[model samples]
Target: MNVPTVPMLFVEIEGVLRKTPDDLGRPWKGPFDIEVFPDAVERLRLWKGAGGRAIGFSQQGGVALGETDEQTAVRTLWTVRERVANLLDHVVHCPHHPEAAMPDHARCWCRLPKPGMLIAAQHEVSLRQQERYPLWMALLVARSPEALQAASDLGLDHLHGDAWRRDGGQ
Candidate 1:
């Protein structure tokens, strides 16, 4: 009998960071924040050994309420890296403000709800291994329902609302 190996799970940050209040809403406190639950780390180790890869991640809110776009981007990336360093094969950051007053051309492609980062990661992985899974799933753990839907529209198999409390079951 051939036992089907479980597919690797791609987790997102932001909503998986901590249970904090923000523009969207409150997320469950992730295991990384408290250090009490080893679930996050354990999951990472499993994924790394099994050749799993996280697709993309973005800040929960568009920076703080009044913080500059640059500040928010920097802080968000730093936080994300620190939190998911164990499981993440690669990370991407979107420096543009979703509500910025700039022209559309000025925006970058790393933003959530967009598949640029995921696409890039998938390409990189494929180049390295030359193996393509039947289903290429990209999980987005943001608070914006709109953003989730956008990602879904972009052909991602999974779009998670929040990663903190999410259980990507086998």
Candidate 2:
């Protein structure tokens, strides 16, 4: 019997794996604000146990809002990564905001709805590694419409929370 190669899982960090801060109370300044959703973590574990890799895709617009910096954003993601340990393979974030005052974090294509980060991840985790998984078999677990659309454009299967939408909001 031939076992199929497991596909990679693309997860949205904020909102899906962790709750976004309701108020601007020291957001992403430290690891204190990080909270890993138990449900999401469990699901991620299942994927990992199945020989799959999981990558986090987050749109960290707080850097543009002046609430945080690239380092802070990375630290926060690392905190979450520590929680899940081996279950999570990598985490990528976008710091761009269209209206950001800082040019460094402004108007980058890597932001959600553009597919830059996802494309980067795709290249980073070579598709050839997962021999049994094709582009359409790659899975994305995110609640954001932009992520859903990006996955759709990339010909991937997407799940929003617990609901699986194959049509991809076409």
Candidate 3:
């Protein structure tokens, strides 16, 4: 019997920031700085080398309203992506508002509390690699327990909080 290799390491963006803005709604106003999770990155590399894949990643902070083009979001995520290219096979983002009153944003599947992004990534990877290998497991990384619980309720694989260090201090 062959053991199936699955994706590992889900890095949460935004909330992991070393600095927090007074207003969460508007974070791009000032010069924002973010710290990378070195330990998580290392783990990701190992998983990738072992034929593991990154099924899901979420941006807990920063609200991106409306159906903005993917380019805009990709640019914002590029910074995070650069740190874990080897670990990450794909990225999923929620560019919608959580509340219904926010018509400009509206309800969408990409949101964190929802598993649409993860599900989509899973399908993408399965289709992309089905000819070569089988998918056994998937992981989700969120900034809060709420997000993790939500992912679990949605049938997502192991969900974890945002905390990454090269030395595995946490």
Candidate 4:
């Protein structure tokens, strides 16, 4: 039997890419100084070299906490995109949290442990590529339990730990 394949990958940002912000709300001031974890760049390269498509997913509730606004968050992500242009195909961010200081920002979808972002990305990717793959067939590379749980809920393949390095020293 012949089987079709989709070379897509979903990766988490916060802990996997950079150190989890000391305070998600006030991680940094002035600009987003993303300190990428060791082997993060390399991992993306290997995955791309193997012909895997990569999409970035991050749960950032900083904006809702009144630390920043949507515009700032987008700008930060834009900077990240510029740096990882060759590796990432696209990025999806969640700026909502249940405990948001801003009432308007509270209680919304797109948070991890919830499949909103993944489902949205899947739909967007399917539309853009003009092809659909079962959610379980997609691969998730990350080190966040929330992202991993979200992957599990969606039945996607998930990998986590030490920037995906063999040694747990990331």
Model 3 clash pairs are: 7-53, 39-165, 39-166, 94-110
Per-residue C-alpha lDDT of model 2 across residues 10-119, encoded as one tens digit per residue: 88876677666742344544666676667677778777787777788888898898877889888888888887654677788898887888777787879888889987
The sequence of per-residue lDDT tens digits that candidate 3 reaches over residues 1-170 is: 44445544444554542223532434553222434555556756665687666643554324544334556666656656665563466666666666535765666766666666666766776667662223234455555675677657766554344433333223
- Identify the runs in model 2 with alpha carbons over 4 angstroms from their true place: 1-5, 22-29, 102-104, 127-133, 162-170
Cα lDDT computed for each candidate against the true fold: 0.49, 0.74, 0.53, 0.72
TM-score of each: 0.59, 0.80, 0.65, 0.80
Position 116, candidate 3: lDDT: 69
The order of the candidates by TM-score, greatest first, is 4, 2, 3, 1
RMSD of each predicted structure = 6.4, 4.8, 5.1, 4.0
Q: Order the candidates by lDDT, highest first — what do you get?
A: 2, 4, 3, 1
For candidate 2, the TM-score is 0.80
lDDT score at residue 88, model 3, on the 0-100 scale:
60
Give lDDT tens digits, candidate 4, residues 1-170. 44345677887776666555672444555345765655776777877788666778877798888877888887766666565654877778999988986766887778888888877876786667665566656678777788888888877777784637444233
* Native-to-model Cα distance after best TM-score fit, residue 54 in candidate 2, in Å: 0.7
Residue-level lDDT for 90 in candidate 2: 74
Estimate the lDDT of model 1: 0.49
